[model samples]
Target: MDSTRTNKLLELLQTIGLQELNSSKLLSLVDEALIHVSAGRSKNFERLEFLGDAVLRLAATEFIDQQYPNLPVGRCSSLRAQLVSDRWLAQLGEQLQLESFLVLGPKALGDAAAQATLQADATEALIGAIYSGSGNNLEPIHHWLTPHWQQTTADVLARPHLFNGKTMLQEWSQAEGLGLPNYTTTEQSSRHGDPERFKSRVEVGSRLSANGFGRSRKEAEQNAATEAVQRLQDVGSEINSESPNNTPH
Candidate 1:
Protein backbone atom coordinates (compact mmCIF):
# COMPACT_ATOMS: atom_id res chain seq x y z
CA MET A 1 0.00 0.00 0.00
CA ASP A 2 1.19 3.46 -0.81
CA SER A 3 1.85 5.29 2.50
CA THR A 4 0.68 8.63 1.12
CA ARG A 5 -2.50 7.17 -0.36
CA THR A 6 -3.26 5.25 2.81
CA ASN A 7 -2.78 8.38 4.90
CA LYS A 8 -5.05 10.34 2.60
CA LEU A 9 -7.74 7.66 2.84
CA LEU A 10 -7.46 7.68 6.65
CA GLU A 11 -7.76 11.46 6.56
CA LEU A 12 -10.92 11.08 4.51
CA LEU A 13 -12.28 8.82 7.26
CA GLN A 14 -11.46 11.41 9.93
CA THR A 15 -13.37 14.06 8.03
CA ILE A 16 -16.44 11.86 8.29
CA GLY A 17 -15.74 10.98 11.96
CA LEU A 18 -14.51 7.50 11.00
CA GLN A 19 -11.23 5.74 11.77
CA GLU A 20 -9.91 2.71 9.90
CA LEU A 21 -7.73 -0.02 11.31
CA ASN A 22 -7.00 -1.27 7.82
CA SER A 23 -6.59 1.79 5.67
CA SER A 24 -5.44 -0.14 2.61
CA LYS A 25 -8.56 -2.29 2.60
CA LEU A 26 -10.87 0.71 3.00
CA LEU A 27 -9.09 2.46 0.14
CA SER A 28 -10.00 -0.36 -2.20
CA LEU A 29 -13.69 -0.06 -1.35
CA VAL A 30 -13.97 3.45 -2.78
CA ASP A 31 -12.02 2.27 -5.78
CA GLU A 32 -15.18 1.28 -7.62
CA ALA A 33 -13.73 1.91 -11.01
CA LEU A 34 -11.59 -1.14 -10.55
CA ILE A 35 -14.20 -3.22 -8.83
CA HIS A 36 -16.96 -2.78 -11.38
CA VAL A 37 -15.30 -1.88 -14.65
CA SER A 38 -11.70 -2.93 -14.52
CA ALA A 39 -11.15 -5.94 -16.75
CA GLY A 40 -8.15 -7.60 -15.20
CA ARG A 41 -7.72 -6.16 -11.74
CA SER A 42 -7.61 -9.08 -9.33
CA LYS A 43 -7.63 -6.69 -6.39
CA ASN A 44 -11.10 -5.19 -6.17
CA PHE A 45 -13.86 -4.45 -3.71
CA GLU A 46 -16.51 -6.84 -5.11
CA ARG A 47 -16.40 -8.98 -1.97
CA LEU A 48 -16.50 -5.90 0.18
CA GLU A 49 -19.52 -4.72 -1.81
CA PHE A 50 -21.38 -7.86 -0.74
CA LEU A 51 -20.35 -7.35 2.85
CA GLY A 52 -21.25 -3.66 2.70
CA ASP A 53 -24.79 -4.36 1.52
CA ALA A 54 -25.40 -6.39 4.67
CA VAL A 55 -23.55 -3.88 6.85
CA LEU A 56 -25.61 -1.02 5.48
CA ARG A 57 -28.85 -2.85 6.21
CA LEU A 58 -27.73 -3.65 9.76
CA ALA A 59 -26.76 -0.05 10.35
CA ALA A 60 -30.10 1.19 9.04
CA THR A 61 -31.93 -1.29 11.26
CA GLU A 62 -29.98 -0.11 14.30
CA PHE A 63 -30.75 3.49 13.45
CA ILE A 64 -34.46 2.74 13.30
CA ASP A 65 -34.34 0.94 16.62
CA GLN A 66 -32.61 3.86 18.32
CA GLN A 67 -34.66 6.60 16.69
CA TYR A 68 -38.10 5.03 16.66
CA PRO A 69 -38.15 2.64 19.57
CA ASN A 70 -41.94 2.60 19.62
CA LEU A 71 -42.38 2.03 15.90
CA PRO A 72 -43.96 -1.23 14.80
CA VAL A 73 -41.75 -3.79 13.09
CA GLY A 74 -43.51 -3.37 9.73
CA ARG A 75 -43.07 0.40 9.80
CA CYS A 76 -39.47 -0.04 10.88
CA SER A 77 -38.84 -2.30 7.89
CA SER A 78 -40.27 0.34 5.59
CA LEU A 79 -38.03 3.04 7.07
CA ARG A 80 -35.00 0.81 6.81
CA ALA A 81 -35.75 0.22 3.13
CA GLN A 82 -35.83 3.96 2.53
CA LEU A 83 -32.59 4.60 4.35
CA VAL A 84 -30.68 1.86 2.56
CA SER A 85 -32.12 2.42 -0.86
CA ASP A 86 -29.99 2.85 -3.94
CA ARG A 87 -31.18 6.42 -4.40
CA TRP A 88 -30.24 7.35 -0.83
CA LEU A 89 -26.87 5.60 -1.09
CA ALA A 90 -26.09 7.34 -4.37
CA GLN A 91 -26.95 10.69 -2.86
CA LEU A 92 -24.62 10.02 0.05
CA GLY A 93 -21.81 9.05 -2.28
CA GLU A 94 -22.27 12.24 -4.29
CA GLN A 95 -22.37 14.33 -1.12
CA LEU A 96 -19.09 12.76 -0.03
CA GLN A 97 -17.55 12.93 -3.57
CA LEU A 98 -16.70 9.26 -3.33
CA GLU A 99 -16.21 9.17 -7.09
CA SER A 100 -13.27 11.49 -6.71
CA PHE A 101 -11.38 8.77 -4.91
CA LEU A 102 -12.09 6.12 -7.50
CA VAL A 103 -9.38 4.38 -9.45
CA LEU A 104 -11.15 3.80 -12.73
CA GLY A 105 -10.16 1.95 -15.82
CA PRO A 106 -10.17 4.17 -18.91
CA LYS A 107 -13.65 3.06 -19.96
CA ALA A 108 -15.22 3.51 -16.54
CA LEU A 109 -13.62 6.87 -15.88
CA GLY A 110 -15.24 8.89 -18.65
CA ASP A 111 -18.80 8.85 -17.34
CA ALA A 112 -18.31 7.74 -13.78
CA ALA A 113 -20.08 10.64 -12.12
CA ALA A 114 -23.30 10.04 -14.01
CA GLN A 115 -23.53 6.36 -13.11
CA ALA A 116 -25.72 6.36 -10.04
CA THR A 117 -25.60 2.60 -9.52
CA LEU A 118 -21.84 2.66 -9.59
CA GLN A 119 -21.78 5.44 -7.08
CA ALA A 120 -24.25 3.73 -4.75
CA ASP A 121 -22.49 0.37 -4.99
CA ALA A 122 -19.15 2.01 -4.27
CA THR A 123 -20.51 3.70 -1.17
CA GLU A 124 -21.81 0.41 0.16
CA ALA A 125 -18.47 -1.23 -0.54
CA LEU A 126 -16.77 1.59 1.29
CA ILE A 127 -18.99 0.93 4.30
CA GLY A 128 -18.01 -2.73 4.15
CA ALA A 129 -14.38 -1.72 3.90
CA ILE A 130 -14.78 0.53 6.92
CA TYR A 131 -16.21 -2.32 8.95
CA SER A 132 -13.36 -4.57 7.93
CA GLY A 133 -10.73 -1.97 8.70
CA SER A 134 -12.27 -1.43 12.11
CA GLY A 135 -11.44 -5.05 12.92
CA ASN A 136 -15.16 -5.96 12.74
CA ASN A 137 -15.95 -3.22 15.26
CA LEU A 138 -19.23 -1.66 14.16
CA GLU A 139 -18.68 1.64 15.91
CA PRO A 140 -16.85 3.23 13.01
CA ILE A 141 -19.47 2.18 10.48
CA HIS A 142 -22.31 3.36 12.72
CA HIS A 143 -20.59 6.66 13.49
CA TRP A 144 -20.02 7.36 9.83
CA LEU A 145 -23.48 6.35 8.63
CA THR A 146 -25.74 7.47 11.47
CA PRO A 147 -25.75 11.13 10.46
CA HIS A 148 -26.68 10.26 6.90
CA TRP A 149 -29.40 7.93 8.17
CA GLN A 150 -30.69 10.61 10.53
CA GLN A 151 -31.25 13.02 7.67
CA THR A 152 -32.68 10.34 5.36
CA THR A 153 -34.95 8.97 8.08
CA ALA A 154 -36.44 12.40 8.69
CA ASP A 155 -37.14 12.87 5.01
CA VAL A 156 -38.74 9.44 4.56
CA LEU A 157 -40.82 9.83 7.71
CA ALA A 158 -42.14 13.16 6.49
CA ARG A 159 -43.13 11.71 3.12
CA PRO A 160 -43.92 8.11 3.87
CA HIS A 161 -45.95 7.28 0.77
CA LEU A 162 -43.77 9.29 -1.57
CA PHE A 163 -40.58 7.66 -0.38
CA ASN A 164 -41.35 3.96 -0.53
CA GLY A 165 -44.93 3.15 -1.39
CA LYS A 166 -44.57 2.62 -5.14
CA THR A 167 -41.24 0.85 -4.87
CA MET A 168 -42.44 -1.40 -2.09
CA LEU A 169 -45.61 -2.16 -3.97
CA GLN A 170 -43.65 -3.30 -7.00
CA GLU A 171 -41.45 -5.51 -4.87
CA TRP A 172 -44.48 -6.91 -3.12
CA SER A 173 -46.20 -7.71 -6.38
CA GLN A 174 -43.18 -9.57 -7.66
CA ALA A 175 -42.70 -11.40 -4.38
CA GLU A 176 -46.33 -12.51 -4.41
CA GLY A 177 -45.90 -13.84 -7.97
CA LEU A 178 -48.58 -11.49 -9.20
CA GLY A 179 -46.43 -9.87 -11.86
CA LEU A 180 -46.85 -6.08 -11.54
CA PRO A 181 -49.71 -4.02 -10.22
CA ASN A 182 -51.21 -1.61 -12.74
CA TYR A 183 -52.07 1.98 -11.86
CA THR A 184 -54.33 4.19 -13.96
CA THR A 185 -55.36 7.76 -13.28
CA THR A 186 -58.17 9.96 -14.47
CA GLU A 187 -58.59 13.72 -14.22
CA GLN A 188 -61.33 14.47 -11.72
CA SER A 189 -61.17 18.26 -11.92
CA SER A 190 -59.43 21.01 -13.87
CA ARG A 191 -57.56 22.52 -10.97
CA HIS A 192 -54.32 22.47 -9.03
CA GLY A 193 -54.37 21.85 -5.30
CA ASP A 194 -58.07 21.01 -5.56
CA PRO A 195 -57.51 17.77 -3.51
CA GLU A 196 -59.52 16.01 -6.20
CA ARG A 197 -57.79 17.06 -9.36
CA PHE A 198 -56.93 13.47 -10.08
CA LYS A 199 -57.94 10.00 -9.01
CA SER A 200 -55.66 6.97 -9.28
CA ARG A 201 -56.84 3.39 -9.08
CA VAL A 202 -54.55 0.42 -8.51
CA GLU A 203 -55.44 -2.96 -9.91
CA VAL A 204 -54.00 -6.24 -8.86
CA GLY A 205 -54.46 -8.58 -11.82
CA SER A 206 -57.95 -7.75 -13.05
CA ARG A 207 -59.34 -6.68 -9.69
CA LEU A 208 -59.49 -3.09 -8.53
CA SER A 209 -57.92 -3.19 -5.09
CA ALA A 210 -57.69 0.47 -4.05
CA ASN A 211 -57.93 4.06 -5.22
CA GLY A 212 -57.02 7.53 -4.00
CA PHE A 213 -57.72 11.12 -5.03
CA GLY A 214 -55.18 13.92 -4.82
CA ARG A 215 -54.26 17.38 -6.08
CA SER A 216 -51.94 16.11 -8.83
CA ARG A 217 -51.48 12.97 -10.86
CA LYS A 218 -48.26 12.05 -9.12
CA GLU A 219 -49.79 12.67 -5.72
CA ALA A 220 -52.82 10.62 -6.67
CA GLU A 221 -50.66 7.74 -7.79
CA GLN A 222 -48.67 7.94 -4.59
CA ASN A 223 -51.84 7.98 -2.52
CA ALA A 224 -53.20 4.97 -4.38
CA ALA A 225 -49.94 3.11 -3.92
CA THR A 226 -49.91 3.99 -0.24
CA GLU A 227 -53.37 2.52 0.16
CA ALA A 228 -52.27 -0.62 -1.65
CA VAL A 229 -49.18 -0.94 0.55
CA GLN A 230 -51.31 -0.59 3.66
CA ARG A 231 -53.72 -3.16 2.36
CA LEU A 232 -50.90 -5.58 1.63
CA GLN A 233 -49.55 -5.08 5.12
CA ASP A 234 -52.91 -5.79 6.60
CA VAL A 235 -53.25 -8.95 4.57
CA GLY A 236 -49.78 -10.07 5.54
CA SER A 237 -50.49 -9.39 9.18
CA GLU A 238 -53.69 -11.40 8.99
CA ILE A 239 -51.87 -14.32 7.45
CA ASN A 240 -49.16 -14.18 10.08
CA SER A 241 -51.69 -14.12 12.91
CA GLU A 242 -53.41 -17.18 11.50
CA SER A 243 -50.16 -19.09 11.21
CA PRO A 244 -49.17 -21.87 13.60
CA ASN A 245 -46.59 -19.64 15.23
CA ASN A 246 -49.26 -17.15 16.26
CA THR A 247 -51.95 -19.72 17.12
CA PRO A 248 -52.96 -20.15 20.74
CA HIS A 249 -53.41 -23.62 22.08
Candidate 2:
Protein backbone atom coordinates (compact mmCIF):
# COMPACT_ATOMS: atom_id res chain seq x y z
CA MET A 1 0.00 0.00 0.00
CA ASP A 2 1.19 3.53 -0.77
CA SER A 3 2.17 5.44 2.33
CA THR A 4 -0.08 8.32 1.36
CA ARG A 5 -3.04 5.99 0.78
CA THR A 6 -2.39 4.27 4.10
CA ASN A 7 -2.26 7.63 5.86
CA LYS A 8 -5.55 8.68 4.30
CA LEU A 9 -7.18 5.45 5.44
CA LEU A 10 -5.76 5.88 8.90
CA GLU A 11 -7.28 9.35 9.02
CA LEU A 12 -10.63 7.88 8.00
CA LEU A 13 -10.49 5.23 10.72
CA GLN A 14 -9.50 7.86 13.24
CA THR A 15 -12.53 9.89 12.19
CA ILE A 16 -14.65 6.82 12.88
CA GLY A 17 -13.07 6.57 16.36
CA LEU A 18 -10.94 3.52 15.62
CA GLN A 19 -8.14 5.43 17.34
CA GLU A 20 -7.15 2.30 19.19
CA LEU A 21 -6.05 0.57 15.99
CA ASN A 22 -2.31 0.13 15.81
CA SER A 23 -0.91 2.10 12.87
CA SER A 24 0.89 -0.86 11.30
CA LYS A 25 -2.04 -3.27 11.70
CA LEU A 26 -4.57 -0.71 10.42
CA LEU A 27 -2.43 -0.08 7.36
CA SER A 28 -2.29 -3.82 6.68
CA LEU A 29 -6.04 -4.10 7.03
CA VAL A 30 -6.61 -1.17 4.68
CA ASP A 31 -4.43 -2.93 2.14
CA GLU A 32 -6.54 -6.03 2.57
CA ALA A 33 -9.73 -4.03 2.00
CA LEU A 34 -8.33 -2.61 -1.25
CA ILE A 35 -7.72 -6.14 -2.51
CA HIS A 36 -11.48 -6.54 -2.91
CA VAL A 37 -11.44 -4.11 -5.82
CA SER A 38 -7.79 -4.82 -6.71
CA ALA A 39 -5.33 -1.97 -7.10
CA GLY A 40 -6.61 0.38 -9.82
CA ARG A 41 -8.69 -2.31 -11.47
CA SER A 42 -12.45 -1.95 -11.16
CA LYS A 43 -15.12 0.65 -11.64
CA ASN A 44 -17.75 -1.03 -9.48
CA PHE A 45 -17.65 -2.74 -6.12
CA GLU A 46 -20.00 -5.57 -7.14
CA ARG A 47 -17.74 -8.53 -6.37
CA LEU A 48 -16.70 -7.23 -2.98
CA GLU A 49 -20.29 -6.23 -2.22
CA PHE A 50 -21.45 -9.75 -3.07
CA LEU A 51 -19.04 -11.36 -0.63
CA GLY A 52 -19.71 -8.75 2.03
CA ASP A 53 -23.47 -9.16 1.67
CA ALA A 54 -23.22 -12.89 2.34
CA VAL A 55 -20.93 -12.29 5.29
CA LEU A 56 -23.29 -9.69 6.76
CA ARG A 57 -26.33 -11.96 6.39
CA LEU A 58 -24.58 -14.97 7.85
CA ALA A 59 -23.09 -12.99 10.72
CA ALA A 60 -26.42 -11.35 11.46
CA THR A 61 -28.33 -14.62 11.33
CA GLU A 62 -25.85 -16.31 13.64
CA PHE A 63 -26.10 -13.44 16.12
CA ILE A 64 -29.88 -13.39 16.15
CA ASP A 65 -30.18 -17.15 16.42
CA GLN A 66 -27.83 -17.28 19.38
CA GLN A 67 -29.40 -14.32 21.16
CA TYR A 68 -33.05 -15.08 20.52
CA PRO A 69 -33.40 -18.81 20.56
CA ASN A 70 -37.15 -18.63 20.89
CA LEU A 71 -37.75 -16.42 17.86
CA PRO A 72 -39.46 -18.08 14.92
CA VAL A 73 -37.50 -18.85 11.77
CA GLY A 74 -39.51 -16.36 9.73
CA ARG A 75 -38.67 -13.50 12.06
CA CYS A 76 -35.03 -14.57 12.19
CA SER A 77 -34.85 -14.56 8.42
CA SER A 78 -36.59 -11.22 8.31
CA LEU A 79 -34.14 -9.73 10.73
CA ARG A 80 -31.19 -11.04 8.74
CA ALA A 81 -32.61 -9.63 5.52
CA GLN A 82 -33.17 -6.22 7.05
CA LEU A 83 -29.68 -6.04 8.46
CA VAL A 84 -28.16 -6.83 5.09
CA SER A 85 -30.33 -4.54 2.98
CA ASP A 86 -28.85 -1.85 0.77
CA ARG A 87 -30.68 0.83 2.68
CA TRP A 88 -29.44 -0.12 6.13
CA LEU A 89 -25.94 -0.91 4.91
CA ALA A 90 -25.85 2.40 3.08
CA GLN A 91 -26.88 4.23 6.22
CA LEU A 92 -24.10 2.54 8.13
CA GLY A 93 -21.65 3.45 5.41
CA GLU A 94 -22.73 7.05 5.53
CA GLN A 95 -22.22 7.04 9.27
CA LEU A 96 -18.65 5.95 8.65
CA GLN A 97 -18.23 8.35 5.68
CA LEU A 98 -17.18 5.34 3.66
CA GLU A 99 -17.62 6.96 0.26
CA SER A 100 -14.58 9.21 0.65
CA PHE A 101 -12.39 6.13 0.40
CA LEU A 102 -14.04 4.62 -2.69
CA VAL A 103 -11.93 3.74 -5.71
CA LEU A 104 -13.84 4.83 -8.83
CA GLY A 105 -13.03 5.79 -12.38
CA PRO A 106 -13.20 9.40 -13.63
CA LYS A 107 -16.40 8.73 -15.55
CA ALA A 108 -18.05 7.65 -12.34
CA LEU A 109 -16.74 10.57 -10.34
CA GLY A 110 -18.89 13.69 -9.73
CA ASP A 111 -21.87 11.34 -9.46
CA ALA A 112 -23.22 12.21 -6.04
CA ALA A 113 -26.20 10.01 -6.90
CA ALA A 114 -23.87 7.06 -6.86
CA GLN A 115 -23.04 7.62 -3.21
CA ALA A 116 -25.85 5.39 -1.93
CA THR A 117 -24.77 2.37 -3.94
CA LEU A 118 -21.09 3.04 -3.42
CA GLN A 119 -21.54 3.50 0.29
CA ALA A 120 -23.51 0.30 0.58
CA ASP A 121 -20.87 -1.62 -1.34
CA ALA A 122 -18.00 -0.07 0.62
CA THR A 123 -19.73 -0.97 3.86
CA GLU A 124 -19.87 -4.61 2.80
CA ALA A 125 -16.28 -4.60 1.64
CA LEU A 126 -15.24 -3.23 5.01
CA ILE A 127 -17.11 -5.99 6.78
CA GLY A 128 -15.49 -8.59 4.56
CA ALA A 129 -12.13 -7.03 5.26
CA ILE A 130 -12.72 -7.09 9.01
CA TYR A 131 -13.82 -10.69 8.95
CA SER A 132 -10.82 -11.71 6.90
CA GLY A 133 -8.43 -9.73 9.07
CA SER A 134 -9.79 -11.23 12.26
CA GLY A 135 -8.73 -14.71 11.25
CA ASN A 136 -12.41 -15.60 11.17
CA ASN A 137 -12.82 -14.35 14.73
CA LEU A 138 -16.51 -13.67 14.24
CA GLU A 139 -16.66 -12.60 17.87
CA PRO A 140 -14.83 -9.33 17.29
CA ILE A 141 -16.42 -8.70 13.93
CA HIS A 142 -19.84 -9.38 15.42
CA HIS A 143 -19.15 -6.81 18.11
CA TRP A 144 -18.12 -4.24 15.53
CA LEU A 145 -21.26 -4.91 13.48
CA THR A 146 -23.64 -5.39 16.39
CA PRO A 147 -24.79 -1.80 16.84
CA HIS A 148 -25.99 -1.27 13.28
CA TRP A 149 -27.10 -4.89 13.00
CA GLN A 150 -29.26 -4.68 16.11
CA GLN A 151 -30.78 -1.36 15.09
CA THR A 152 -31.83 -2.76 11.70
CA THR A 153 -33.08 -5.99 13.25
CA ALA A 154 -35.15 -4.10 15.77
CA ASP A 155 -36.61 -1.82 13.15
CA VAL A 156 -37.58 -4.74 10.93
CA LEU A 157 -39.04 -6.91 13.67
CA ALA A 158 -41.03 -3.95 14.93
CA ARG A 159 -42.75 -3.79 11.55
CA PRO A 160 -41.94 -7.12 9.99
CA HIS A 161 -44.41 -6.88 7.15
CA LEU A 162 -43.20 -3.48 5.99
CA PHE A 163 -39.64 -4.34 4.90
CA ASN A 164 -40.18 -8.00 4.11
CA GLY A 165 -43.41 -8.25 2.11
CA LYS A 166 -41.50 -8.92 -1.09
CA THR A 167 -39.34 -11.62 0.40
CA MET A 168 -42.27 -13.21 2.19
CA LEU A 169 -44.33 -13.25 -0.97
CA GLN A 170 -41.52 -14.89 -2.94
CA GLU A 171 -40.87 -17.46 -0.23
CA TRP A 172 -44.55 -18.27 0.10
CA SER A 173 -44.85 -18.72 -3.64
CA GLN A 174 -41.85 -21.03 -3.85
CA ALA A 175 -42.89 -23.09 -0.82
CA GLU A 176 -46.25 -23.71 -2.49
CA GLY A 177 -44.51 -24.86 -5.68
CA LEU A 178 -46.16 -22.06 -7.61
CA GLY A 179 -43.06 -21.79 -9.78
CA LEU A 180 -41.43 -18.39 -9.84
CA PRO A 181 -43.94 -15.57 -9.73
CA ASN A 182 -43.68 -13.58 -12.95
CA TYR A 183 -44.40 -9.88 -13.42
CA THR A 184 -45.79 -8.39 -16.61
CA THR A 185 -46.10 -4.67 -17.09
CA THR A 186 -47.80 -2.19 -19.41
CA GLU A 187 -47.16 1.53 -19.34
CA GLN A 188 -48.67 4.64 -20.84
CA SER A 189 -46.60 7.82 -20.68
CA SER A 190 -49.52 10.16 -21.27
CA ARG A 191 -53.15 9.68 -20.40
CA HIS A 192 -56.09 11.88 -21.28
CA GLY A 193 -57.25 12.09 -17.64
CA ASP A 194 -53.81 12.17 -16.00
CA PRO A 195 -51.66 14.31 -18.26
CA GLU A 196 -48.83 14.82 -15.76
CA ARG A 197 -48.22 11.20 -14.95
CA PHE A 198 -47.38 7.89 -16.57
CA LYS A 199 -49.61 4.98 -15.66
CA SER A 200 -48.46 1.39 -15.32
CA ARG A 201 -49.95 -1.95 -14.38
CA VAL A 202 -48.20 -5.02 -13.04
CA GLU A 203 -49.89 -8.36 -13.50
CA VAL A 204 -49.37 -11.80 -12.10
CA GLY A 205 -51.36 -14.66 -13.52
CA SER A 206 -54.58 -13.08 -14.83
CA ARG A 207 -54.81 -10.54 -12.05
CA LEU A 208 -53.79 -6.93 -12.39
CA SER A 209 -52.02 -6.86 -9.07
CA ALA A 210 -50.79 -3.28 -8.99
CA ASN A 211 -51.38 0.12 -10.57
CA GLY A 212 -48.71 2.80 -10.38
CA PHE A 213 -48.09 6.20 -11.95
CA GLY A 214 -44.60 7.57 -12.34
CA ARG A 215 -42.65 9.87 -14.64
CA SER A 216 -40.21 7.17 -15.71
CA ARG A 217 -39.99 3.44 -16.34
CA LYS A 218 -37.65 2.72 -13.46
CA GLU A 219 -39.80 4.57 -10.97
CA ALA A 220 -42.94 2.94 -12.39
CA GLU A 221 -41.39 -0.49 -12.15
CA GLN A 222 -40.34 0.06 -8.57
CA ASN A 223 -43.79 1.29 -7.59
CA ALA A 224 -45.46 -1.57 -9.44
CA ALA A 225 -43.19 -4.19 -7.87
CA THR A 226 -43.84 -2.73 -4.43
CA GLU A 227 -47.58 -2.96 -4.93
CA ALA A 228 -47.37 -6.40 -6.51
CA VAL A 229 -45.56 -7.76 -3.49
CA GLN A 230 -48.16 -6.24 -1.21
CA ARG A 231 -50.99 -7.76 -3.21
CA LEU A 232 -49.43 -11.21 -3.21
CA GLN A 233 -48.92 -11.24 0.53
CA ASP A 234 -52.43 -9.98 1.11
CA VAL A 235 -53.99 -12.81 -0.89
CA GLY A 236 -51.40 -15.55 -0.48
CA SER A 237 -51.61 -16.25 3.23
CA GLU A 238 -54.59 -18.60 3.57
CA ILE A 239 -54.04 -20.14 0.16
CA ASN A 240 -50.47 -20.94 1.11
CA SER A 241 -51.38 -22.74 4.31
CA GLU A 242 -50.96 -26.50 4.04
CA SER A 243 -53.99 -28.72 4.31
CA PRO A 244 -53.83 -32.25 5.69
CA ASN A 245 -54.11 -33.66 2.18
CA ASN A 246 -51.25 -31.58 0.84
CA THR A 247 -48.98 -31.87 3.86
CA PRO A 248 -45.63 -33.41 3.18
CA HIS A 249 -45.20 -37.08 4.12
Best model per lDDT: 1
Candidate 2 has an lDDT of: 0.59
TM-score, model 1 to reference: 0.63
lDDT of 1 at 39: 38
Residue lDDT tens for model 2, 1-249: 687888777776666555455457545655545442433563335554566677888888787777677766765665666677666777888887776676666645655455565676678877765655556456655767777666665555554445654454455566666655454445563432222245556545554367655444544554565576666656664423211111111
What shift in Å separates residue 212 of candidate 2 from its native position after superposition?
Answer: 7.0
lDDT of 1 by residue, 1-249 (tens): 477756667666767876535455556554432255453577666888888999889888887777677777876776777788776787888887776666667666565334666677778888887777667778887788887777776666455545666766776677667888898999987743356678999887853378988756776887898788777666653111110111111
- Provide C-alpha RMSD values for all models, in order: 10.8, 8.5
TM-score of each: 0.63, 0.63
Q: Residue 204, candidate 2: how far off, in angstroms?
A: 7.1
The 10-residue segment with the lowest total lDDT in model 1: 239-248
Residue 100 of model 2: what lDDT? Answer: 69
- lDDT for model 1 comes to 0.69
Per model, state how many residue pairs clash. Answer: 0, 0
- Residue 218 Cα positional deviation in candidate 1, in Å, after optimal superposition: 16
